[model samples]
Target: MLVAAKGERFCDQKRPGCSQCARKRALCPGYRDMSSQIFRDLTQVTVRKYHAKRSQSAIASSSQNKSPKLVKAKPSLSLENVALNFFIRVYAPSSPSAWLTYLESVLSCTDANSQLSLSAVLAPAIAIFSHEQKRPSLMYIARRYYLTAIADTGLRLTSIQHAVRDSTLMSINLLTLFEARAFQGRSPPTDWTTHIEGAVELIRLRGNDQFKSVLGQALFLDTVNNIRTSCAQRRIALPAPIQDLLQTLLQKDSPPLSYGILEIGVGNVVDNIIGLVAGMQTGAVYCNDYKAVILEGLRLDSQVSELSRQLWSIQSYRVLPTDASGAWRWSGLAHDYDNPQSARLWNLLRMLRLYLNKWICRAYKKAVFEQQQQQKEEKLLEMGQEFQHIPETAASNTVLMAEYILSSVPYFCSLILSLEASSSSALSSTVRWLIWPLSVVAVSPLSPVSMQIHARDCLRKLGEEMGSAQAVEIANMLDNSETLEDWYASHPRMIVDQKAWF
Candidate 1:
C-alpha cells in the first residue's frame, strides 16, 4: 500500500506498492495479497443484510398493492389518423354532395390501391388544415401529397375499370376541391376549370353507369353542379355532353322531389343562361336579339322560380325571430331551415335568380341602346315607355335576391359557431355553400351599399373562421375593386370580353 501526505495527488494503482514513498526515500508499507484473504467467513452479517433487504422489498410490495395499479399508457395517434379524422369530422360534413362519405369505405379497404385513396383524401385535408391553422410548412407537405394523388389518379385513369371506380372518381373530385380551396387565388383560374373538365370527361365516359350506385349518382350530380359553376365563371356554354348526360340521368333515375332534383331543374335554366351569355359575347347572338334573349331569360326565370316554390313548399323553412339585442341580425333577419341542406338549396336558388335578373338587366340595356341607335326619336320614346318597367323590375328583383342571400348569412354563421359536434357536418356544408352566395351578393352592382358591406364582412369572417380560401379571395377582390366593373376588369378570366355581362 502507498500512503501520501495530505494535499498530494493519490497514487496510481500499479504492480508494486509504495512507489511514491520509495521514490521519496521514505518507509514503504508492503502490499496485501487478495488471494490469501479470499475466504473470509461473515455468515451472521450476511444474514442480517439479506433480512433487511427482504423486509424493505416486502414493504414496497405491500404499499404498491394497497395503492392503485399503474395505468397502461395509450399509444399516440399517427399523423395520418389525425388528418383523416379531421377530414371526416370537418370537411366531409360540410360538403353539399356528401360524395366524400364514400371515402370511409375506400380507405378502410386493405389493398394496394387503397393507399392512393388515402393520399387523395389526406391531401385536401392537410391543405385545408394548413390554411385554417396558418401553417405554411404544412402546405408543402400538403402539396407533396397532392402531387402523389395526381400521379395515382393519372395511373388509375389509364384503365377504364379503375377510372370509373367510385374510389377513383372520389379521388378526382377531392382533387378538384383541393384546387378550388388550396390553389384558388394562387393557381391560374383555369386550373380549377380544367380539373373540373377532366372530371366531366370521366363522367361522360362512365355515362349512365355512373348513376348505378348511390355514391356514383351523388358524384355525378356534384360534377354537374361544378360544371355549371365553371361554365358560368368562364362565360362559356355548358358542354353539350354534360347536358345530354344530365337528361339521361334524369330519364333513368327520375330522382324524387328533393334539393338535388330542384338543383337539376335550376341547372338547366342556368345552362341556357350561360349559353345566352356566351353567344352574346362572341357576337353569335346579335344585339337586335336582346329582346328575345330577355324573354327567354324571364321564361327560364319563371321555370326556376316555380321549381324553387315547389321545393320550398315541400321542405319549408322558418324565419328565426330577430334578436332583440341585434347580435344575430344579418341585414335585419335570419332565416332558419329544417336543416342546413334546405338552407343551402334556398341560397343557391337565390343565386340563380340573381344571375338571371342580372343578365336580364344587361339585355334590357343593350336592347335600349340598339333601339336608340336605329329608331326615330318619337318611336324610340314609345319603345322606351313600353320597356320602362322591365329594367327597373329586374334591378329591383336583383337587389331583393341579393338581400335575401345576405339575410341567410347570420343563420349559417350562428350554426357554424354554436352547433354541437354531431351537427357540425350539416352546419359545415351550409357554411361552405354560403361562401358562393355571399361572394355573389358582395360583388353585385345592384346590392345596396349596406348589404355589400355586410356580405363582405361575412365573407371575411367565413374565410377566417371556416378556412374558406375562396371566400377570402372574393373579399380581397371586393376590397381592391371599388366598383363591379373594376372587379370584372381585374378578373378578365371571369368574363370573355369587355362587352360581356357578368
Candidate 2:
C-alpha cells in the first residue's frame, strides 16, 4: 500500500499516512504522539499547594507529567566495525596472557592473521632477564634429540645460518645457547649466536603481527635492562650471566627482536601460576630458554602497570544513563558482555590472581560460572565504592546507544524488503519479517490517544513529579494526542515486495 513517508530516515520507523488516509498530514502517527505508561507505581499524584494560591500568571500544576522527550542522536562507530578488529588480535595480542593463555583464550582469535592459537600469552624474555649471573656452565641437551630426528645426518654448511635451518640442528643450537655462559658474563659461545639467529628467522617467517604487537623490541629491551639493572643494584648471585649478552644486543642496531614482550592484559601478583606446557618445539630460535625465562621480567612490568590501568578503567565506567526511549544504556560496550574498560579490569584481576601462584590457570578452568560471577560482582562493588560519585563525561551516551541499535534495524528492514521482492504470494508479501519483531515491541504500554484522556494524566502526573513548573510543560506536550501503536504501525515498508511475491 502507498504511504506518505517523511524524511528517508524515518521510513524504517514510521510513515505520516497510509494510502487509506485521505487527509494525510494529520493522519500520520508516531511515538512523538504516543502515550507512555512508564513509571506507574506511584500511588498518588499531588498538586503543588503554591499553584492553589497563584494567579493565572503561575504555570499550570499538571505540566510536569510529560514524557521524557526523544532527542536527535549523535553519530558513532558501528559494532561491526569494532568486532572486525577483535578477532585478529585476540590470540597474540602481545602477551602470554593474551590469546595464548589457557587453551580457552584461543576462542578470541577469529581473524586470519593471529598465530599460536593455543599457547598461553606469556612473557618468557622477562623471565630469562630476571635471573642472577654467576658461574658459567655449558650444556648440550639437543644433540641426542637431533640424532633421533634428522634423516640426512650430514647436511653441511659453512655459515651458522644454514646449519640452524635443518630443524633438528636448530633445536639443538637453542638448547646450547640457553645453557651457554652468556648469563655468566661470558660472551655467548658461537652456538648461542647460531640459535638466536634461527629464532630471528622463524619469527620473521611465522609470527603473526596483528596481534603479536606486544612482544616487540621495546619489551625485550625493557626486560634485559630491568634484570641487568636489578642485578647490579642488588648484587644478587646467579648461576649464569644472562643479562650481559642481552645488554650488548640492546646496544646493537639490529637484533632478531620481537617486541620481545608486551604487558597488555596480563596480571602480576595475581596470576603467576597456571599449567605450562613445555615450550613449542617449532623451528624457532626461541627454544633458547627465552619462553621459559621471559615470565619473570613480565611479572615486574606487570606489577608496575596494572594498578594504573585498573584505576583508569574503573573511573571511566561510573555513570549510567537512560536513553531517550527511557532504556538504560551501558558504555564502552564491545559485545554486550562488557566494555573495553571492564574487560581490561577483568583481565587485570584474572591475571593478578595467577601471579607466581602455580596451577592457577588449570584451576581457573575448573571454577564454576557462578564462581566467576561472584568474582565479577565483588570487583564491581569494590570499584563502585571507590568511584561512587564521578559524573559521566558524555551527556549523549544514551543517545549514541539507542541510535546505534536503531541504525541496524534499517538494515534488517532492507533485508525484509529484499525477501518480499521475491515472494510470489500476495498474503505472504505483506507479512514482512521485520514486522513480527516490531509488533512484539509495540503491543505493550497503555497509551492514551485523546488530549482529554492522555493530557490530564500526563500533566497531573508531570505536575506530581518534577513539580508544577515542569508538569505544565509535559502535559502540553502530551496534548498532541496519539498512541505509541499508531507510530509503530505507521512505519513504511517496501511495497514492491508484494508485487514480486504475488
Candidate 3:
C-alpha cells in the first residue's frame, strides 16, 4: 500500500492495501489498531484546577479577615495653631521692627499672661491672613480674638506686677497693631492712641529695670518710637513722661547703640520743632519771636544734619548708578543700602529733614509776610538783612529734601520686585515703611508734578498689591486735589489739620 493512502485515503475493500500497492507500484501503509488509537478528555482536569484555585483564594481571604490591621490617624491642627505658625514663620520674619522679632521668645514663655498675649497675636495674624486669603468668615474669629485679648490685657492691668510684665506690654502693642490692621483707614485715632499711651505709662512704671533685660529694652524702644511717630503725625509734642523715659533710656549703659536709638534722637528734635510751630500757630509765641523761632529751627536743623552725617558714617549707604532714561521714577541716581533695614534708616533720616525744613520754610514765609505788613504800615524797609535770603534758602532746601525722598523709592521698589512669590509676607513691612515717606513726598508743595505723580502711583501699587489701606487713602487724596491744602480741605479728618498748619 502507498504511504500517502494511510488514514486520509481509503483503499478498495476487496484487496485494499494489496490492490492499491500493485496498481501504484508502491506499498501502502496500513491503518493503526483500535487499542493504539484510544484518547482521554481534559474537561474534568480543567474544572478541577479552576475549583482548586477558587478554594485557595477563599481560604486566603478568610485568614486575612481574622487578622487585625493598623492605620495611622492624621493629626488635627486648630485655627490657633495655624495662625501662630503663620505669624512666626511669615509675619514675624518680614517685619523690620525688632520688637516683633522678640515676639517669638515671648511666645515660648510659660507665664500665664504671656499665653494670653499670644492670643493677642492671633488677632492681627488672623486679620492679615484672612485678608490675604480672602476668607471673610475668618474675620469674625479674628475679631473675637481681639476682644479676648483686650479683656485679658485689662485683667492683667489690674495687677501691678502683671501690668509691668513684658507679656503685658507686648499685648498692648499687639492690640494697637490689630486696630491698625483690622480697622485700617477707618479706625478711630483714639483706638491706637490709647494703647500707645498705655504702653508708655507701663514703660514709665517699669522704669530703669525694663532696660536690664533685652525684651524690656526692646519694648521700651518700640513704645517710644511709636509714640514719637504719633506725636509728629498729630503735630504735638512728646509727653513729659515719655521725655523723661527717653532720657533715662539714653542714660543707660546696658543697651547698645543702634539705628533706632539714633532715630529717636532725631525724633526728639522733630518733637521740639513741632512744639515750636504749635506755639507760633497758637500765638503763644509773638511775631517778635519769629526770628527766635527761625534761629531755633536753624540750630535744630544743624543738629539733625550732624546726626545724618554721623548715621551715614556709621552705617553708610550707596548711590547706585542708573540708566539715563529715568524709567524707575527716581529723580536722579538710585539709592541703595546694605539691606532693606539700612535703606529704611536712610529714608527715615530724609523724612526727618523734610519735616524740619518744611517747618523752617513755613516760619520763613510767615516772617517775610509779617515784614511786608510792617513795611506797609510804617513805610520803611526795616526787614533784617540776614533774613533776605533765608526764605529762598529754606524753600530750596525743602525741595531738595523732597527730591531725596523720592530718589529712595527705587531702592525699595527694587527690593519688593525682586522678592519671590513665597516671600510676599515681607512685602507688608517694606510697603508700610515706604508709604509714609512717599505720602510726604506726594503731598509736599515743593515736589515737582512728575515726582508727585510717581509717588501717587507707587502708593497705589502698595495699596493694590500689598493691601495697605493707608496707602490707598493717601493715593486717593492725591488724586482728588492739586495741592495738599486742597486735600486737607476735602478731608478734614486727615492726620494733619490744614487750619492748624496753614
Q: List ranges where model 1 is wrong by over 4 Å.
A: 1-77, 109-116, 132-134, 184-187, 256-260, 286-288, 320-325, 328-331, 377-386, 419-435, 453-502
The numbered model that scores best in lDDT is: 1
Q: After superposition, how far is residue 262 of candidate 2 from its true place, in Å?
A: 5.8
The TM-score values for the models, in the order shown, are: 0.70, 0.19, 0.73
RMSD of candidate 2 to the truth, in angstroms, is: 32.3
Candidate numbers sorted by TM-score from highest down: 3, 1, 2
Provide the lDDT at 112 for model 1.
Answer: 41
Model 3, 1-502: lDDT tens per residue?
Answer: 2334544444554434546655666666654433212212332232233324333233234333433241111112244545555666667666534567766555555443334354477788777667555666787778876776776677678778778888888888788777655653332466767787787788888887887777777777667766765665555677888788777777665433353556656656766766765566554663456667777777777877887788788788777676557545564567667887666666666766676667666767776688787666542234457666775777677677776777777777777767635444455456666877888888766667777787888899878876776578778867877444333222212322111111
Q: Which regions of candidate 3 deviate over 4 angstroms? A: 1-77, 111-116, 185-187, 257-264, 277-289, 376-384, 457-472, 482-502
Worst 10 residues of 1 by lDDT: 493-502
Evaluated at residue 401, the lDDT of candidate 1 is 84
In model 1, how large is the Cα lDDT of residue 501? 12
Q: CA lDDT of each candidate? A: 0.64, 0.27, 0.63
Q: Give the top-scoring candidate (TM-score).
A: 3
Question: lDDT of candidate 1 vs native?
Answer: 0.64
lDDT of 2 at 250: 36
